[model samples]
Target chain A: MARIVGSIMSTHVPSIAGAMSRHAEGEPYWKPFFDGYEPVRAWLDEVRPDVAVVVHNDHGLNFFLDKMPTFAVGCAPQYLHADEGWGIPEVEPFPGDPQLSWHLVESLIGEEFDLTTCQEMLVDHAVTNPMQLCWPDPDDRAAIRIVPVTVNTVMFPYPSARRCYALGEAIGRAITSYDAEEDLKVVLMGTGGLSHQLEGRRAGFINKEFDLRFLESLTEEPAWATQYSGEDLVRLTGSQGVELLMWLTARAALLGGARKVTSNYHIPISNTAAGTVVLEPAA
Target chain B: MGTGTTRHEIPGTTIFDGAEAQKGYALNKMCFSFNDGTNRAAFLDDEEAYCHRYGLSDDQTKAIRDRDVLRLLELGGHPYYLAKFAGIFRLDVQDLGALQTGLSKEEFQARLVAAGR
Candidate 1:
């Protein structure tokens, strides 16, 4: 049976990629951010998860406003680079694990989690930025398989934090029920958040305290984390707080009482808290 | 070739009024800012300066500028951003037109929902 070896929650600020590229050699603005993820990079190296089920939100890529699915799972063999304006820089197209993705989708729906499946989809920075950051490619790195899941946080009346959490629990159940005989270790990665507004006069505001508390709740008391509605979150932490649902979902997928392996928090990441936390099942 | 007279006589010709055009400009500006690292950095450095440079109003300069989205739908009618805007506002497609195009919102949403959008 497939087992979830661990879960990771990381903020998907597009600048993270820019930071990594700049910091790989060493740049001032991004050095601190890159430093924070070193431990996370080490953990990923040590665990060496076979597949990563990434949960993120698309910024109008794939299922644009015409029809936004609350949760869409990628069942495609490969996903193309989205022309999200200027487009991605020097990155290879992402490879998808359709078999495992479909299995998880079927298993989740069978477990009562309604999932919208996509055969062809393009992923935006939300998925790519974190992937580039967490798994910086080696000289001849083996490709890492991905199962991309999207949440509807881009639109209003988005699924509540509770719903995302429930989906995560369902994902955990789905993975647990997989009939595969291989020693599959999957990593549940939640990308997006720790407080920065993307719109209006309050656009560049950052709530450091709220971000810290959110990271605390995410690791120590995730159940309490889902009580906040999107509106409540926006009011407290600006509209970007909506991304917190991704973290809650990651938390829900973990085995209860997992040990947090690495936690890092940095502020003013181009006007946001670039926070990350990795949790692993208790040994 | 189509006659200029017929094109000029098209109804809703004034749909792209000054306000509507401004909204489209704002939306494009935001899209540009999102795409360009230098622009985004300048905007982050000083929002007021960025707005002044872009020639956008204070309301037009907000971070999550959905008004521009609404305006783009009104003027140009790009389904891509409209769909996203509709999803963002949770506004039914039909209702969006009825509200902006003088159609009944319910009927518009119904048509869109029926069309599988």
Candidate 2:
């Protein structure tokens, strides 16, 4: 049986990738950011998760205005970089684990998750940016396979935070039921969030205090976190509140109580809080 | 290869037809906010400025000068501006990528087809 080794919730700001990709070990802009994740890196090295299930929202990529599913899963062998208006940056293609992904998909659907599966898809910064932060490597692309899950946050009438948390629980059930012989240590990652508005006149708003409180509530009282519907979240934190659905992943991982390994918060990464948290299952 | 005489042929009809254009426009309008007065004004002003600056063909200039919503939508991909147009046209939210609640694609498609596409 497969078991979730840990979970992570990180902000998906594109600039974080830009910072890490360009700076050295102790450079001014990059030092604090990389240093913050040292403990997380050590934890991951110890746990050695076999697979990572990343929950992220596509930013006008793949599912454009044509059709955006509430939740889509990638079962492809590889994922290309999604072009966001301006073409894709010079980045390595993401390798996917088709077998594991399909198994999880079949299991989830059997468990009644209603997931949409894709063979070929493009992933934008929402998925890759935080990934670079968590698993920073140039050549070790195939070290761990990924199951990419997308949420609908671009348009209105998005899923409620509670619904997202429920989805997480379903994922937990599916992972445990998979018929695999190998010892599978799964990592559920929720990427995007920590209050920052983007769009219209309120493009540059940043609430560090709100971000910290939200992070605290995520680990301590996840149920309280889900009370805010998508609409309420938007009203309180502008349109970007849609990213709160990423917390569902954390909620899912915390089904049996997660031991907090590391947490860090930084400000003003192109008008957003660059925050990250790593949690492992309690011993 | 040596140069050879070649006949240039243009098809009488194309995929970019009236219905497709209309569908594209509807999709864009449904998805964006182009119906707002400010956005409409900016669009009109921009069209005029583009026509004047580029010295484009009469047909091209007319496409912009006339404010043909369908033509404009066909030219530019569906964006936020289309939502405003959707509001103005009163497009059905279902037609604008709202997947049916608690239903699979096959189930939703069957219902849609039964209701007449």
Best by DockQ: 1
Q: lDDT tens digits, residues B1-117, model 1?
A: 211222122222222223433444554444434433565556557756765775655555553344443344444333323333334344432334455544464554343333221
For each model, chain A TM-score? 0.94, 0.92
Off by over 4 Å in 2: A24-27, B1-117
Chain B TM, cand. 2: 0.26
- For all candidates in order, state the fraction of native interface contacts they contain: 0.06, 0.00
Candidate 2, residues B1-117, lDDT tens digits: the string is: 212423222121112223433444433432233323454455446755534443444554564455443344345423233333333434322222222123343453344333221
